[model samples]
Target: MKARRVLVALAMMAAALPVAATAETLTNDMVVALVQAGLGDDAVIAKIRASAGHYALSTDDLIALKKRGVPGPVIAAMIESGSQGAVSAKAAFSADSPDPLAPHPSGLYLLSGPRMVRIDPTTSNQSKTGGILGYAFTGGIASLSIKAVIPNVTARVRTKHGRPTFYFYFDEATRGLSQAGSPSLWLSGPASAITSPNEFTLIRFDVKKDRRETRVGSMNLAGAKAGVMDRDRIAFDYEQVTPGVFKVMPKADLTAGEYGFLYSVSAGAGPGMWGNGTGSARIFDFAVHP
Candidate 1:
């Protein structure tokens, strides 16, 4: 009897809502209200999929929703709805526009004024393992470090901006026409499949008279490992612009120097790997000029 009365009340409350042809935007409050009124997770998720989502899904907002008895699946659905809305909003970029946010080929591109310039990949041929002398001198107490060296003193691509913004397009669908009739090719082989900028490391190169070098890994008594040293690595922030696309920018202003986005194929492989090499790695290199 009590359960029947609750269902009747819920139906009456739902019927009282405005009956417009357009689906109303779903908000956090409405979601909480629906959950309080005894809607199942599937029903709530289906509603979210049908309506435009304007949910406040911040950490606090999510906590509040959970406290209000919203299920985990419903919260997940809200997050997905918000993500789709954000992607749809960015999808408005004109197909032919030269904007960096516009559709681009599957590669890394630096934003140059109104143009999106591709950052070509440079293969590192020389791998210099160092710190071994320190280890030997200390009776294996010190760690050994490995560095990848590029033969060129300067990169072919140069940017005047110390903190240039870069865009990464991972979608093969966008490769058509934008590539100037070139055959479909992965710009960085295995690195091309990455979906997040976290997979890449931004490193400042130590400029030499004829070559630029950066540490790729360090080896201790334990074993060999792969990664850039903290001093050589530049931190950056990234955001998803649209599906399969991301915008990356340095967290702080970069100093004038040679830099590259290094993506290693496997742990401890370092950046010396090219497709033809023993291991695989890719470096999208550029020089930052003052």
Candidate 2:
């Protein structure tokens, strides 16, 4: 019924879902396959192959993964490993983490035309301002990406007049994420374009966690838009869809450019994870560009 309760229910469902794999139970074939595919390292592959337990993976979309860099060896190992597997088979983050409404500063984003402006493994190093929590820096599994869709961008690009027609447009949500802890299209472009003062809007879904003690209620990601959007950035109050997972989107325009707008998710001891000497927050950044 309530938003928090609904999120908790969804989390329960997630945990109830059958895990696809366990370490030590993977086969050598699975290992080599991932390495060839460029997903994980050799050491990771070997460990996964030697892992234990039944793998929950289905048909194992080897070819499909190749396009996303699942690497034959990595996917195989993931199929063998479980949620704790070293290979970031999938991403896990929630907007309810530290400073749920943390804003992504504005800047300029550059985009290479005809390119999807997708955030790949190469965009991992981008950063704006750092956060005090474990997620302070721009590093995390980018599961989603949203940009402000500014109008008249095409006209400015073609005209010699340096018009401010660049609009920050994301796919209504974090469109760059690949479901895995990697670069998404939204966070892989020019950092300056997305974080600029008047470029993109940073929306953070603010989900209430301390609703009178008994952590209850939940919300849905569907139809959920950014909390606030301006010519520059959009901010969303934290919305809890479930633990280890979060989602948000844009409500305004996003200009075109090549930049990396990343999300910081801290499930462990990375940057921005530490809080007021209490609970820790997972920080992750999904990069994207126009």
Candidate 3:
């Protein structure tokens, strides 16, 4: 009987070993730090470490990580490459670097800076395009309006089994047609499948353009429509662009003027806003310029 009891105890201990071996011994402080650090899930850590590599991180690095839900400072500290750091920092400082689109933080922002003048580039949760998106610009003296149909661009998504839950990406680039001389939305919200939204939103930025101190302009647009179902957004902006286009210098060439900018847009809610649509805003010809 005693021998039989010993054998049973041994079997129970063996059964418990697997659970103990597989368990991850993480401390509370460690878990908290990881979360506060924006470690998110285990997969997030791997992706951050992988793409970040040995590169040193900066504000742009943090912005890139923001798209990934990682902590900004942590990402900034992790960048190991100078080129990557510069690239990411540029994104961080430029308002044009992002626009609203699909599942995640999809909100359109139209901005113009020295050398980097990108047009409507859509930011979305994923790739699901069915209709139009909007763009607004803030300039020194001009209020511009823009509209066009969103084209479905390929998006990067994470899957559980085979189902894609989240997507992140930029839209296809749009070409500039003849410039409209007045403040207007060149196109209504998205109208074409393979094209970019029109450039209709604008704000005159010349009020404070010449000041050595940084200047800002704001734009507000509202009551527009998003191409997807139930997608709604209200976009506001403040901008200041140097006068010497394409010149990245400490002293900005403002054409010597006192300028102020205002641009804004409000679109009804759509599927693109909350994963209700088939695709998301990738990016567009969203622009800010001279």
- lDDT per model vs. reference: 0.75, 0.32, 0.30
Q: Report the C-alpha lDDT of model 1 over 26-137, residue by residue, as the tens digit.
A: 8999998888889888898999898887888789999989998999999999999987866664455342345755655467788877677777678776666667789899
Higher-scoring candidate on TM-score, 1 or 3: 1
* Candidate topping lDDT: 1
Residues 1-290 of candidate 3: C-alpha lDDT, one tens digit per residue: 99999999999999999987774433223333566675556644444444433332445645655665545444433443334544554343332232222111112222222222223333333222211232322322332222322223221211111110111111221121112121222233542221211122221121222211111112224332333111212122222221111111112222322111112223325643323332233333221122
List CA RMSD, all candidates. Answer: 14.1, 24.2, 23.2
Instruction: State, as a TM-score between 0 and 1, how close model 2 is to the true structure.
Output: 0.18
